[model samples]
Target: MTNLDIPATPGAAVARTEASPVGRVLAEQAVRTAAAWLAEFRKSPSTPAAYARDLGLAAVVEHHQLQDLVEAFPLPSVRTLFTRSRARGVAPELCWFPMLLDLGLHPVLDATPAHVKGWVALMDEHRDATGQPVLSPAARARRVAALSSLLRWAVTEELITANPVDRLDRDRAGLVVDRHHSPTRGLSGAQLDLLVWTADRYPGPQRARTAALVALLATTAIRVSELCGLATGDYFADTGRHVIEVTRKGGKRQRIPVPPAAAARLDAYLATRPDYGAVAVPGQHGAGRVPLLATTAWRPGAGRRGGGQPLSPGEVWATLRRVARTHPDLAHLADQLHPHQLRHSVATRLLEAGAPQQHVQDLLGHVDPAMTQRYNRARDQLHNSPTPLAGQLLERGLAALDQDQEHHPAG
Candidate 1:
């Protein structure tokens, strides 16, 4: 391998020594640090303390990955090493792994613009392979977010001093990722009545209970995950205000306020709740707290004396399916329905009603107002219950174009 000199960078100077063995050890440390930091960031959200630790780790990983490249080939800089490593079938996420190996043998790897582009290409490949571009808008946003977090870590570690992914530019492509448009898809006046009627047929104690769950999701716009996480004790019975505490993706908690109608549904569900067993302690809201939803198959066991354990989110889907199957009219509507669609339905209704963007953001636990605005946009594009008139118009336009082509006779 050619001897590579570490360029002087103010206070940060790479030591160039003849001792290749010692240099290799340093590179290994760098690789380990990068992996450790990435793992830590995955476990924790973007906090000052978390970023600090990740920065230290990024430095280690970048050094090692670069060292491995230098030791294997006559690479002059970190950028060349990254290119050579990528050509050897190394993915972007695993770029640190190879870079760390190279750094263990050298002082520092030179990261260049060309090499950074190569890294970005690798990231794009991995993203496409893992169903990012082709997935739902929500899923695509989530994947981009995950990749951004790792790239940010690289920035703090001074691996490349800048996030290359941030430099990726996109042109006008129909709709931006995070932007919300008002949706035309919502239950019509008659369909809404049908849904309520079907939900009401759940039989006895299950009647009001099941209908309430669906109604609350539509009216309150709370996430289905948050709905399932609720406990019977989450409500203030006397005040008639139900507070739902939700833990979002990054372990951030947002408390959503439930309306009076939702509160009444919850109260009704609580009233009909069968006596599973005794309360372990007074006002312990955690595990010992009464489960908000339980199944008929639920039974008391070793630590669980309650009649039913807390219902999993899957139960929510099953309950909806059961109600849909029981009612013919509702079956047509509910067959293609998902819990999140109900959330979209509610958000659309609220935005149409002229609710404040900030209020919607707070209610939906969205980190940004832009995200909450997509629903608003989607709502405007279509009315409540998209009519077939637009479809008919599209067909007529296509027919007219075909007739014009026949008369023109291009051949």
Candidate 2:
């Protein structure tokens, strides 16, 4: 059999040659193994290879002895699928896997919780040219979140059976922090309102799209990735509610009811285009295939007589920054305004309006309530505390009983 047909184990490959098995494969960068696996699977008539192959053999996988391509890579191959579009996001995270391999967790099967911790520690300790730590708390959080995402993808690809990142003590590992920093601060309530208003001042063509994009993000709090991934058909009537479906982090599709202002703006913007916003749902095909927030500048001369390319996350960032710069009122925010801050603004605004904490958590799609609770920096104020409100409610009942005794001489 050709070397191509042979499945090399770490020990076996080591025995065959005195080279470090991890360094050997990684030196060549293992792009060949990842590509070969993808090529073999892509040939399937039904595309079983699109998601399956020798994924099964990887499951006896947890206790470290690395398997062939099972431990080799779904990394570079999966990254290709995402990097095809800038909006797919997380390509930078995927880039980190090679560094992970360099740390001796070659097959991915070898990554344990301790290795994950050490990987993050290395990143945290690394210094940049400024002589400060390269990763801040927020940057460290992103690395952990990115690692979690990668490990989860590996699990789904069945490259390995268990996720070491999942077992991580997220808070202890410094991924979750109750402490708020300047980085976590979002726009003030008035600032959020000003942001949407700022969209109206977008210079030149397609102001309707600019307004709708800003309003939807400011009002609903969807991620920039979710906003960019939205298909025209994702907006549809659901039992009298105007709901928009978005692919959330990790490919989870969620439908959130659009508020009146966002819905009105979106509908008005959609009216300007050929599709009129009444596109088919994603699974239903072509009518819904166009981008919901397409940029007029993109593919201006191409495609159907109507639509343009979907906005990338970078485009969304620029749009917000541009809108902020347009108005004197938003000048201070021009440099710092971003799509994520809009999302953060939405969550905080909802909480400040006395919306239930649980509802806010659900609205923001946070799996951990702690993540949601971290947004309310003012929640501890006794003046605004719900406990006093409860006591006041009881006082009204006591007052009523006192009135009854005065009127009827009740015991």
TM-score for all models, in order of appearance: 0.50, 0.61
Candidates in order have lDDT scores of 0.46, 0.56
Score candidate 1 by TM-score against the native: 0.50
- Best TM-score among the predictions, by candidate number: 2
* Clashes per candidate, residues 3 or more apart or on different chains: 39, 0
lDDT of 2 by residue, 97-129 (tens): 444343443435555676666656655566668
lDDT of 2: 0.56
In model 2, what lDDT does residue 115 have?
62
Count clashing pairs, candidate 1.
39
RMSD in angstroms, candidate 1? Answer: 15.8
RMSD for each model, in Å, please?
Answer: 15.8, 14.5
Off by over 4 Å in 2: 1-95, 100-118, 127-132, 145-176, 179-183, 249-252, 275-288, 297-307, 374-411
> lDDT tens string, model 1, 1-411?
211222333332344343555554665544444344434533122232223222232333343445443333221122222322232212323343233233232212343334334433433344465576433333333333444565566668775576644654422211235455533355543344344445655765467668778656655566665676556554442233345544444545544555554556666766666642333222334435555665444332213323455554455776677776776666776656667666665655556656566566556656656777543121211112221221222234435545765899546
In model 2, the number of clashes is 0
